[model samples]
Target: MSESSESTIESGGIGLSEDALRTLKLVADDEPIPDDDPGLRDLRALHAVVPNTHRPGHWILLDPQQTAHNLLWRGIEEVTGILDRLTHVPKITEALTVEHERGRWRDGVGSEYIEHADQINARLDQIMASATEELLTAQPRKRSKSLLTMALPRDSALLERGCKMRTLYPYSARVGVHEPKWMREMAKRGAAVRTLSIPFPRMIIVDRRHAFIEDLVFDSSPPHSGWYVTDRPVVEWMSMIFDLYWTRADPWSEPLDQAGRLTNPIQRSILRELVAGLDQKQIANRLQISEKTLSNHLTDLRTKLRFKTTYQVVHWWATAAENSSALELRDGEPFPNFPGTEGP
Candidate 1:
């Protein structure tokens, strides 16, 4: 080869350094190269130059083309083997996953405790992505607008796949600027969203086969972890709980009006919580509203009903519970009209 071509090979066109190319050339021409020559190291490493058994201290150069061909052939074989293994990876993984899932099923231990919020979100994405039949969620706490915005694309994708999605939120969520609009947008996309006046636990059920719920410690104290559950009985029970709440919740699109009642949904929820013997702070927490907001709602209720004090409000609530037949009566639907309870 010409010097330039030899230089190219030396510079890694073929991984043969310039000195190694020189050693090769000398060997090819039947010229003896010194054992300690600088170029001999590269030639020896490549195995292109070998010891001459008949003449000690002498080296032989194999045909370069054949040597190149051999290297190329070996490389091709190695890469083909890697490709073949890569092709089978999915099958092997799938088989192992099947066995793993079955073992968990048989052992009645199909739950994973995830501690971090980010990890929980990631697992939720995976669960939702795999959902083909239905998605159900109950959120007892209010969500930030940013969180709702982040979930829009994923929820939209689920709806687009023709999967049924149902979500339940506290009635206090309707007081937000973003939540009602987000709920309506999702409802328009064929998702069923409802607001409940009563308290419920946070849950996410996919296909009625898998679920995620809050994790509690051995002492029944919350550790801020999540349990990803696939246990059949547990998941089924959770699904039923969701269905029970869902049936009683008011649809997102409908205004909370029951025959032109005076109290709205939030006020009714506050009244119910008060009737349940919850203090202002506890009522606010359960209804997913601030204490000030809860107090404001109570003040509005008092003004509307022409009551003078909180005691009178609760007293009337108790009396109405017994005598008001046309009223909400259950699950905190908007209160129906009483004979003299009309307000502007």
Candidate 2:
């Protein structure tokens, strides 16, 4: 056979190998081939040859072209059936999804516990890739440089697709070296970045439909285990929380603008915690700042105000003009009035 013909035969044209074709050809010429040959079994399987009943151990070869035609016709039918099934896959998947979601509203809510960092990242990527409306994230603590690096492209793509992105970070994050750069880059890409002095729960909300939050069971650890929430009520509540903080937050444009005020929001938060009877370490932990950084703020306050002790600072903060109003951290929740201040 020519090279092209052999190529066709090898490509399942007739579902017969070259060896089988050769065996068939030999049988057609009445050549005495071995009865136990492997090609003989293949030729028989393809119906390309039949046993000669009158001549024991002899075979009869059918027309190769006819055998090829029959085999190709059957293959074509199988392929057509597969194509028909392939066309139904998307519709079938959609129907199954609808069925799975049936009565889910009455079932209260749906949540998944993602137990690992990689899985959480993958799920977020999947969710963000299809997000159309907005993404709201509250990161109370500073993010690692590596995590920020990995998220830049994914976030930029979300912004490029016209998704409104807003992120909330603690005031301490603004002083970080790498995080500020990441925040600035994101802000430049039309993302609304803000910082709050008050501590808030970390969460990510996509399109106001889904939310991801820390498990709180592992909040003291470094792993990224978390909960994926799809309940409309729960997600809406988280979104509301984010909006409340965002309302009181300062924008990324002015990182350290005092506005002629003596203390920044972060310093005010430290003072607030101090007046609430928290020690230096506890205040630092709550504000997501290091103890050293917290001490620096105190030292700066003491030096600027010409005071010698933290007690003096707290004394002044209680009677300060700014602490008079109720500090609203959440809906209907406000800080209690200090000793020298009046309630709202």
Candidate 3:
């Protein structure tokens, strides 16, 4: 048979055609095997059975009894074939495809390529356009004019869409009249406001689907200018971080205690630090306790007075002290008696 035909037959599996068998017989006949030739009897036996089975390989010829043994080998080959196709080839192809796609997308559309402020703004606008249900924000004590300018308009638009809004601020914001006024207005129009002494991470989650976190380098900058936007995995990570602080934060329903009425040593310690404007970490260090433990005590105090922000706590303490002083002045003897002794 031709070499091309032989290659085609080998590609399928080793099988003897009539022409190939005729050629094999002629070759075996011409190669005369003497009676003393090693394994001459075995060769003659193999040639006898070569035309009987479909596979004309030596295994069937030399050991026809081991034909059943080929079943075990065939089973192994079948299993190897399946594993190569399913587990090896397809998995490698999928991984390579994913990596190639990721490289192309990142190289072409990644945030690192955005150089201008307008490019960043445009990206955020695209995100905002798709937001559906809710938006949660945490802003720092100090606000920038540009952020406020952009945020106020965006906040208004979100409110009009009936999105639920929640904002967290530092207690120091109470010193700014404008912040409280803004909070009150936002609260009046379906937003909730809360305050904590702890500093909050700058974050925004839209509809629980997309979240934007301030990049480490841009933590102190405007978020729209430098932030990462992603889905669940990143958002859930930021949400956990927020909950770590939120659990320690005082509830908004608590009324402010202005008076220094917190007399317990731990409560008083926390109160003194608050009055001194020391942060929670400093208070924890001074008292030789963990910040988490200090926060627990503060939370206990908040529950007692029904106050939220540390500012409200201090404000309540001051109000109580003023009331006590006014009562003391009322109890003092009238000064008029000294000037009008002749009235008797």
Best-fitting candidate, measured by lDDT? 2
Q: Which runs in model 3 stand beyond 4 Å of their true positions?
A: 1-121, 217-225, 250-254, 258-344
Question: For this target, which candidate reaches the highest TM-score against the unseen true structure?
Answer: 2
Candidate that beats the other on lDDT, 1 or 2, i.e. the better one:
2
lDDT of 1 by residue, 213-311 (tens): 886632322355677899898898788777767766778778787665667767777877787788999988877888998888889878988988998
For the record, the alpha-carbon RMSD of candidate 2 to the native fold, in angstroms, is 17.5
The segments of candidate 1 whose C-alpha lies over 4 angstroms from its true place after superposition are: 1-108, 218-224, 321-344
Residue 322, candidate 3: Cα error in Å is 24
Q: What's the best-to-worst order under TM-score?
A: 2, 1, 3
Q: On lDDT, who's better, 1 or 3?
A: 1
Q: Count of backbone clashes for each model? A: 0, 0, 12
lDDT of each: 0.77, 0.81, 0.56
**Candidate 2 C-alpha lDDT tens digits along 1-344:** 34544544545555566677778777878777677776786677677888888887778888879988878887899899999999999989877665454334224357876668899999999999999999999999888899999999999999999999999998888888688899889999999998888888899999999899987643333467788889898888778777777766778897464556678778888999998889989999999999999999899989989999989999999888767334424235544333456746
Name the lDDT of candidate 2: 0.81
All candidates: CA RMSD in angstroms?
18.1, 17.5, 18.4
- For 186-277, candidate 3 gives per-residue lDDT tens digits of 77777777666544577766766666554454223344444445646667666656555454444344444434455333455466677778
